[model samples]
Target: MGNWESRLYSVPPQKLGEFVQNSLRPFEDCQNKIDKTVNTICAVLQEAEQFPLVISVAKGGSYGRKTVLRGNSDGTLVVFASDFEQFQDQTKSPSEILHKIRDVLRVWQLTTELAAQVEVQMVSGTLTIQLSTKRQSITFKVLPAFNALGLSDKPSTWTYLELKRALDQTHSNPGEFSVCFTELQQKFFKNHPRKLKDLILLVKYWYEQCQEKLKYAPLPPVYALELLTVYAWEQGCRTEDFDIVEGIRTVLGLILQQEQLCVYWVINYNFENVTIRNILLSQLRSSRPVILDPADPTNNVSKDKMCWQLLKEEARIWLSSSGLNESPGLSWNVLPAPLYTTPGHLLDKFIKDFLQPNKIFLEQIERAVKIIRTFLQHNCFQHSTTKIQKIVQGGSTAKGTALKNGSDADLVVFPDWLNSYTSQKNERSRVIREIHKQLQACQQKLDLEVKFEISKWKAPRVLSFSLKSKVLNESIDFDVLPAFNVLGHKNSHTAPSPSVYSELIDLYSSSDALGGEFSTCFTELQRNFVISRPTKLKDLIRLVKHWYRQCEKKLKQKGNLPPKYALELLTIYAWEQGSGTTNFNTAEGFRTVLELITKYQQLCIFWTVNYNLEDETMRNFLLTQIQKTRPVILDPAEPTGDVGGGDRWCWHLLAKEATEWMSSLCFKDGTGEPVQAWKVPTVQTPGSCGAGMYPITQEMFSFRICRTLE
Candidate 1:
């Protein structure tokens, strides 16, 4: 892994070296502008009587380290103050000092001279000043810190002395005060081999380019990448004469591996001190891809594991390129480019040709639903009052997103015998067993000439079975789930009352704490939410599911993938957030969903049509669920159920697929316009437009023709 020549890649070492040099040559003008701005600011602050006495300002970050890119780059100006004790005493906290410094700078910013020198922008508490020249402008974070330089003269009075004490007792970081050690941090990377610095710049360039394309979530900081490059160089054949191409590949390969990367230097900090040692050890063990700050042991820079995974996903794609494969001569694919261009009618045809289900499959699914419903009705428990209340259809079939080749339906039977959700949970296994028995009886009773494919004996939450028709030469699968009729008893015209959710909250709080535990009880609401969507939106949902299925096939995903239901809900959320209309760009909607998949970490989608925030208990629970973590698409029907779950890897795989698919021709048309979204009337009521939420009898299904099939 350390040898670049041993590893297969499309570009020759010479070619890569040239590309690296051409892309990452540092600009001296940008660095000079930053230096001049720091000098001018320091000079002005020293002259201002109202401001704190200025000691000296120094450059920091990439500029200070001499690893900045040629064009627009970020640098930091560390403003050290003489009145450290007074500033610390007067201010409420260390963070307040930054605000105070920014406030003073804001006053100075209004001055014609200062305004002409730089444009001020306040971020979090730090002041960012952008200095403009004829060619370009460079931004710098103006961090004000207490002078800790030459601490040997006043060892007892040094802020670092007190800061170590404060940090030991209370884990509060001294904020930007850490910038006092900026010179040390910059010095750490300053004297590294010129090749190492260039290698770091190349990695930075790749990261920046990938970031533009993969806007999935917040990426790991640039500092982390620099540190990673440094670690790679130090660990792997440490030499100034090493291949730059090898160095770049090693860095990217490390990112792809995503192993626990814990690297730190003992040059500055000592592990001999127990406090520092413990802190360092804990940070080192914090999370995978852990890169502890060499300057500050307490700060583990690689804590954003998801962001690193996104980077890793990109690396994997680059690593898999045929050009990169271990072959003879150099032959790589062209540079990574955007796949889809314009919003046209590609998505419309995708829906019509691939996504939309055929009439025969829909007919088979309808027949299966009726057979299951009739079986549950006939097998009424003699001991119970209401045997089978109603059989509600769900999943892609009910949501109108069922694919033609491989699709499924969920038929949840609400039994009146089960008093509540709790009862259903406790007795679901028994109910499923009875239904399984009755399914065998129904098969004998109907003798419907449909082939019974499998005979699995076990029945847990859902009774599974398969039916195949000789005429159609196809099979349709069903998972018959038995649930309590909580919502069935309510009035159909009006929404369920607050009491319904309040009772649900109590049930959830008292029941098992596992997510999606009570989804069976809310199958009706879930079906209704999907079935109530507009026709075009349903088509969009189908397209997304098709993409998901493609990912599953392409990735050969064996274990539990992120649930298909989550993707359905996500499509609806995208449509609602984008153009919530029947007539919108299909390609745009598809692109939006794919883009959202990349940003699965920030996904917090839920519907309140059936349930609102008016109910306090339900509202609180709902809020808690939404705030849990990334890919949090709360089950609109069952608040406890998070459909976008299983593992982060599930979403990771999908996000990677979305990234690759975004580069395909499927999204474009002849004129190069991206595929357009479907246009249909906004639908009302559940089970309308052949979404089939309500179980249709054989007669109704035969007569109620759907235009989708036509």
Candidate 2:
């Protein structure tokens, strides 16, 4: 058996303790210096006639826990506001209180150790300040919190529950009450064993050191690692004199092995109570590495899978060293190394590297596109024989907005046989059967290095087939929808004839039965509309699509939701309404789409870029469709199709997610300025549509009057 202790002791026992303490000296000094600065700021607040709202200030977070790391150690200055209780009473938002505190803090004009005046940057959530002396600079995150329970004993069930309820009910912001229980948080990790604290410092040190190595991947919060260390100690024999190195190794090992480690403490709250237990259980069962904040049950510190994967990979690297490697008869059970990840930075490159398709995937998709196009030209029907009129590539891949690992292509097959709207409506079923049979025959004949699975649909508008390539070891879904091309081959911006939609309107029994049934016919125009957009707009579309996928996977959402195509159109509409340039801000574009999504019910978007309501038949159809209900995004190609009709729950979920992601690093640049959304489009309601001015644009019946959110 390998000497695990010897491996851990290889650094030398005395040196290990000295090395860790020595490494911690700078952080200790930084924390102390920050404490002094915080004290000075509080003193200034107390004396200043301008800062009457400031009540008290205290050190919290890493400094409070005594687990601050070297380099950039984060300490929080909890500013208790005098108007906090009043704000709660008046039902003011957390941001409102924070901004009020921030405005007062800005007026200090106080001198720091190094800088002439303190440098303050006001972000949406918190205030960040740089406090420096001659030799060292400390960064402290100033949090404006309320002392809901001042100097009280551990909070009772009702106290915690009421705070949580307030957080949930008030101002729709998640993280609204993050600082509400700062005192409780400080007390949770207040009196841990010295060795365990040392081990925490060591794990945090490892985490900080690896920041440069895994810059692209997100890391779980340091507090999570600290909690893991505590869990290891509490569960595996609580010993004061336990080996510090062993503890470090065990914590890393647990992190690597933790599929789902739900760690919590029942000291303050009763877990036996059904309400509290269910809440705790829900937190535990949430997206993996679920370590609930011991004090506040709402905050799951390890919800991000990318962060967990990155930490796990780093842990594996550390454990692979001498002595720490798997001993005889023991399994470290580590997964293989991750694929070589390209560095992610500069919104466009990040989207391309992490989110957009790579060269290999693109090549595979290109090959698949070729295969489908060839099959359409050779095997698809013309008259009664097998031939196609036009094969258009649609969806994300065609629009050049596909993500790296997630994407699907649409092959719009315009058959020569299906002449008019009635013919297509009556014969599409048999045509779908024939196309399905022919696709199978082609797959059998080609016998390519791919596993093809064909799906059967009730209406079967599109021939759905999933292709798994043997070489790429990835799959690309292809939906071959047979259509009738009323508008012949044309560029992306060219307008299709009004007669095409007129033909569509002729077939519908009632105004409610719009052209969604003839969606396949307008596939070409749909593809072209997005294909002709600016490069920046395409990238923005990719970003929105990426966020949508995240919303689906993170929320585990199911059932019929708003289609990706609708969101894509919404992004374009936002861009056109705002910048409409090739070099516009990507993050702003992303935020605009999110804002639009939150305002989905009020959305009334339509574009006459492809087909305007010129003829009375098409005009009446669109006018009725536009004023029908909420979220009216009329398909530009097929005006009868209202693509925005979906369940309201999905839109609500997206709005909730957008509210959360507004403060994420994804939507911010290096300077921490939030990407501001453009003024929403002016939506035209039913009462105002008949203002005598018929056409909004040069094109007939192309008016867009959207009501911008106040």
Candidate 3:
């Protein structure tokens, strides 16, 4: 994305002004938007029961974009994607409680700013300032949506200033702004006035600065936008919302600078078990003559036998939040009792699989946990098992979401009120402590130096964060969420069985049926739902409408619930609505959930890649894809061989034609030529196996990075 950024210096002056006006017009509502945000925040604060939740409220931008109305006591919205299992809460209103989760993780809608005032109000709940409640008829006519769209068809980039001014003038008069904005932008603005205005202004200021900067030297795609958002945070509030805002902010900043920018963001990764995955990647590198058990006719996932309903619940919850009420147990829903640990295991597994190549993953997990544990143990937190979990608890996930050699892990921890304030400053520091310790441990344990982070959220009684490990010779991360334990609840001081933890490790290795009836049910249910979700929103809406209608019809019967109750109940029904008890209240919640869903789809793709009974060539394609370290689509004309010497890429880069020498330098099909096979034994089968192959050797065998994205 950085290299792909544009480097345009400027645009015509009049066009610039036009664009800027378009940017500013809709932002007249800044005061109102800010007021709602603050109000929701303050409201949650007043009745808040948790601390880390408060932290989420404070760190607004980290999640995503919404009208960003408010925060909640639980901070469920920010971490919904990590929640793969259902939570106990059923009555809570997710929409009212937290903004529904969204899809795009990086900020997208804004390039400028939203219209909102910080908000002034009550002593307790009573209003003090007598604010004016008035309206003005402002309209401006400039261009038609069609004309703007037509203009956009040209290869041109406008100035941020032009867009903002255009927006301002438009709001000063909507009649005119409509004429300036492109049909696509207009369509968006008509539906999202706040977001559109925000983008316009962001572009105006940041893009202008980017243009000005280009006069000096080249800049990263997100440089200008990053500067602007960071500048805004420095100016006033550094709300959690800054994270999401920064996302789109950075991209637009780059786009504004240049017009034909082509950057690719990593949408997803593939893997599930942290330990096993790292080991596999390491083996692929160190093991010269890598041998995969081709004799075994087995695929990773058992889709055909899976339970849809249970899978749905697991996918909904675990994928949303990494940490939950309890470490997942076998749910009768999707997996057999022995297959998966719990509904939440889905997300945990996804993270591990996605980052299979990383080396120091486990060390980070333990380190992250220890950081929180040590902090609490050293400070106001008591070591009592029963009380500790309740007062201090949250879950976390980590992988190779790094930028440089030895990057830190995205370790996000959210502690409740009692735990967060228990030691105050040291509370967030505790998570950092864990990250530092774990990195050190990873070095010692895995013989690999590591770097990681522990970011804490600042909200009402909340302390949430993300930690990223450095990428040195390998990629690794530990995104762990440490939750505050339930104080008065029975869970306080409860410790999971040591065997259970080991069992989880074992489960990853073997294909065992953990649960029977329950697992089948869960699997079947999950499958049905996935098979049902159509591509069109209209279709989904229709389904929801029909569901409500059904409930309404039931109301007319003798002992049925009322129509109003039915309406509300339908929405309340978590699993039926697509997301079960997983809390999604903020932009973060929505984004995380959406991401999890996408990952779930990827899992399907992975499964398809590995298993295709109807298609005879699928297994070969998948195996070759694994060996070649690249995606392999089915094509009968081209067949894949065993993965081994294929790992030796770019030999031709250093020497000449490596094709002849490459096979000699390395092994193929677990066998190599004279020079390569001499070290490893040559297969000398009976005359039944006509032998024309030479012995292979491991001598002079080594690995090197032949290519890199940068």
Number of the predicted model whose TM-score against the real structure is largest: 2
Q: What are the per-residue Cα lDDT tens digits for candidate 1 across 489-556?
A: 67533457778778777866776656777677677777777777788888878777767765775566
Model 2 alpha-carbon drift over 4 Å, by segment: 1-349, 380-384, 442-451, 456-459, 469-473, 488-493, 509-514, 554-559, 646-650, 682-710
182-260 in candidate 3: lDDT tens per residue?
Answer: 2222232233334333443434344334435346443332222322332233222323332323323233322222221
TM-score-superior candidate, 1 or 3: 1
**lDDT winner among the candidates?**
2
lDDT of each: 0.64, 0.64, 0.26
TM-score, structure 1 vs. true: 0.46
From the highest TM-score down, the ranking of the candidates is 2, 1, 3
Model 1 misplacement above 4 A: 1-344, 379-386, 447-449, 556-560, 646-649, 673-710
In angstroms, the error of model 1 at 544 is 1.0
Model 2, 1-710: lDDT tens per residue? Answer: 22432333345434556667775545555556666666777686566676576666766778767676655566677777767662144255457655655676676644334232356667777577766654445566777666666667477677666666675666534334656666777777776777778878877777766665667667887788888778777754367886665566667767776664556665667454556655654554455566767777667776676768777877776677554543321221111110111111246765654465556657766776687678668745543564577788887788787765537878877777778766666666776788787777666665454557777655655678776654332566778777676666665355666676676777674544444877777676677777778877888888788778657645664544677888888888888777767898776777788778877778887765655545677656766776666787878777767777744336676777776555444455545455577875646332233112235432333433222211
